[model samples]
Target chain A: MDAALKKNDKQLTVAEKTLIDTNLLKRISNGDQDAFSELYINYQPRLIKYCSRILKNDVALAADIVDEAMIEIWRSAGSFSGRSQPSTWIHSIARFRLIGYLRKNKELLQDESSEWLNFKDDALLPDEEIVLSERNRDLIKNIGKLSDKHKEVIELVYFRELSIKEIALMLDISENTVKTRMFYARNHLKNILSSLDLTDFG
Target chain B: MNKKQLKKRIPIEALKLLPWYATGWLSPQERGYIQKVLSQYPDFRSLLDAERKMINVVREDKSILDKSCLDATEIRLNKVLEQLSSTNEKNKKASKGVNQGVLVYLSNLVSSCSPKMQYAVIAAVTTVTIALSFAFVAPLLDENNVYYPATSGVKKSNNNLTTLLVGLNIEPTDPRLLKILDENNAKIDAIPSKSGMHHLTLSVKLNATQIKSLLKTLRDNKALFWFAGEEF
Candidate 1:
């Protein structure tokens, strides 16, 4: 399995990977099943995380959403204009589907409000915190303390490793808004860490 | 001003972009600028390391989806793919329906024309169609005398080769079938993949009357030919 994965990776450059993805979409547009399967394996993990977050950690629901989004990809691949990165295009489709699901279930309203309410100041007790690396654990805890808007930018950049432009395009926000959110989220995370006596963590 | 002072001096914009820098998502120019800043303020290197560590920590929390969920997703994806295939086939059939609609539309348009104009248009279309057909068919017409399709008269040429799709009554390997075709100066050009059919090329440049005679000759041999018809 490891050898197969390494062969699959092939360690292509980012531009090469994007080019391959664009080519795959073109093939998918022509109803190529093998191309769709290759794209599915490449995107499943990240898409699961992205959709799971938006759907409030409902991994099963996120997988269903991912399936629906993949179906949309297969349907509309011919319409991909290649203006944006393929990753941006695919993530935008997943975001649109997830938002649509939330709106349909009337969960968007509750989700927005509950997102802030769900931020627990005490993410881990003192004893539980000792079980993990205090600095890494504190950083994760503090990141969770951020507002949904701010936390999204942080997650997109730090965890997903998306460019500012890509995240802006995916979220339908300006690049300035993405940067500003990251800025505020960073400061807010720092303050939260400082208050928790993890000031020197950074 | 020592290490603490230099660390404090790091730009807020640079700090805001540090996550992207650590993740290598920044452009070359932005990365260069960040690298310059980090070089000038060596103490800020710790912050960059911390950023990298922070990313690793966040990515380490892989509780989002398990293997079972992903396996289920693959099954669901296959279902979607099945639906997509059937949908595509339906779409192809619907597109054919659209083509048929276009033909109906053209027919209606033809009907809207005056009788004389319609006749003129039809005549023009028929002329063009026949001209195109002949133009395409002319290349296939070799030195061999070309036979038109069933119910059409044979076009005689110098070489009197007539191709016929003959259905055999007896087994193909039967000697009587070869004897009858050999008597008529016809040889099997190709044994068709379909059952009961063979392409016989008759080298006797026969005219319409002679072809009729040949047909009668084959019909007389009930043990050999079941059905025989000329094809181009």
Candidate 2:
């Protein structure tokens, strides 16, 4: 049984994932419409969800952000460097497009309080795992208290699974700056969760 | 090492490194530093644990995002494919039309040149015949006092010859004749005929030299003339 489980667990490694994604990117770069379509089908759902979370569950706006990001992916797929994971690279693209959408429509972001409440309620319910539930509720609440910059870093690096280097490139900031924002964001979350009585939740 | 040194550490300013640390992404040195610090401070140990949990929660949320985004992307891809197909069709039609137009224009051009060349050859032949006829016939008519067919009843009376009705057919419209008449200070009576011909009765006294000069000028100018006179 252990051997069977181990075999099942031996899925594609990170390097293998990167290789496959890179191959797909290379095909896309060569104007292979089928390859590009495959990429779209593979990543669009994740991108839309990321945008929705970042943009505070504005589904229509999230859809627009996802569309814009995919269009950019289509245009710039030929330039994909194997320097990062394909998902990380694509997450960065979605983040950038989401920020632009938010900035362009500031009023939508201002009305995001209701969306944040929904996100917080929904976030707390997804994980039945005790540790995950406590941590998720703490994060959602603390994220609402963060500055836009700090929240952006946390969302990209932690939530979106982008590396510090990838986040730096996408935000057009230094790696040091990304680190600084992340550091403060974590500290802030820790303080916020501490005030919420971490033992009671545990 | 000292509590003073530890207090001054200020969370490594590189606490930014914690996100990478939570994900087990740190280099050995960085991880060692963090571990050394965490061992020294029990509070930091708990903080690191909390940070890892937070990162996990975020990762879970992100995973959900992945699935939804892919669904949205499928719809977008379909739209793009539709647009590309339409553009390809339009481009194909445009190219076909351009090719057909070019072929038709070339065929018409090739066909048109032969007829145009034929017309040009006919025009050139007609021009040359006219030129030669004028050169030969003009001098002969001018010397013989001939009346051109286009003019009738215009006559020149010759004193040395019998008083026969000597009708000299000359083109009254000719500039050379008009100039000659003007030079001699002569007048002629012009009568218009129904056949678009003009009849002129000359009233000028002409010596042999003047008559010869007038004939030479008319011949040089290619004025046509003919004789319509009483038969002897």
Candidate 3:
């Protein structure tokens, strides 16, 4: 029995980890600060990573966004339904907060100051600098060659890590429409990436 | 079936299936079907390879937030909680003071009303004074203005001329029909009326027979209204 339990534990996936964290969220909902802290520790890194992509690497701004979203999570944790997975719920919260932050600081997101700051920070990383390195830039340039709808699906799915169902919800489109977009986006991306030298990342 | 037969069976747009295939979202049965098709056609295999590379590039792009920022976020959240608690405490004390003041004022005001009943006796005299003023002025108002219904008949003037006037509750966008002393014509005028209706007065030079023909035309167009006259 012990050996069987050890084998099952060793095979635990990301989804399993998320399910365990959600139980912690249930306790946090009842005003358990310790459970809330545990939930935060489990999910904060991924949430921050997601925010960084959306906010484009202003650590302070990303921190502020994560702070606001987590605080909202703390306040509204009692309202979480098990209808969706906990990660999905938390992701929705993060996306909502990020959009709110962008709306409030519309000028900052648009102006050269944010981009300039990100560009300056690019030199700090040596191995895994920014994902949009020169090779990725070439890939993006070729992706720009695709139709707008095709490019949108690729960005939302791969870059944002949104599931097809989530993408359908976000875009207010049908699941078939999301699938169709993904189908075209993948094909177009394939065509573009084929022309470039992407073997280095591989 | 041969590779050519398989290629012909699958639509070219099925090439769009490559992304879902790369994501491993395709069901086992569907994957087997695709594999069998690909096996017979080796040329499409390179497209599948390219699809795989694209997925890799997308997944490898890491999220921008790091651990230190999340720690800082926790500290900021605690500060917000502290501020909220302090504000609630301050509000509680302020509200207690406001409730006491309001209660004391209401009690004093309620007690003062009973003894002041003699001063309240003047209200009846004030009402009678208002009633007398209204009775004296009402007839003068009636003499200055005449009330006309939406539909009325034409009245003859003192000079034996027949006149028809149309009254509208709304401003009429259409032209008006008028007959005066055996002649028939229509005019659109901006004349105002006393009782919130738009008025048009028509004086006819023609006889009543011609006036009837003009009135028929106005009636067909749903524009005719009966005339109202007061001998001033």
* lDDT leader: 1
DockQ of 1: 0.10
Q: For model 2, how does the per-residue alpha-carbon lDDT over A1-202 read when each residue is reduced to its tens digit?
A: 9987754544434345557778887897676888877776666654554565655443445665676777677667865655556766666566546544543444444434323311222322211222332353333333335556766777776656677778889999998888877766665444334444442111
Tens-place lDDT per residue, model 3, B1-232, is: 6543544455554454556566666657667766875786675675577567667765674221111222343565576567545765797889988998877775565556675653453454457667865664443343335432222221222243344433332345533333321243334346633322233344436565765665555434433432222111
Of 1 and 3, which scores higher on DockQ? 1
DockQ of each: 0.10, 0.07, 0.04
TM-score (second chain) of model 1: 0.31
Worst 10 residues of 2 chain A by lDDT: A118-127
lDDT of 2 by residue, B149-170 (tens): 3222223334443221111245
In order, the interface RMSDs are 23.5, 33.3, 24.1
TM-score of each: 0.35, 0.30, 0.30
Interface quality of candidate 2 as DockQ: 0.07
Off-target runs (Cα >4 Å) in candidate 1 are A1-12, A111-202, B1-73, B108-115, B119-232
lDDT of 3 by residue, A1-202 (tens): 9998865664454346556767877887776777777666545544555565555343445555766787777766766666555666675566556644654555434433323322213322222222223243243223225556666777776666666667789989997888777764554343334334344211
Error of 2 at A80 (Å): 1.0
Model 3 chain A scores worst on lDDT over the 10 consecutive residues at: A123-132
Give residue A97's error in model 3 in angstroms. 0.9
Best to worst by DockQ, what's the order?
1, 2, 3
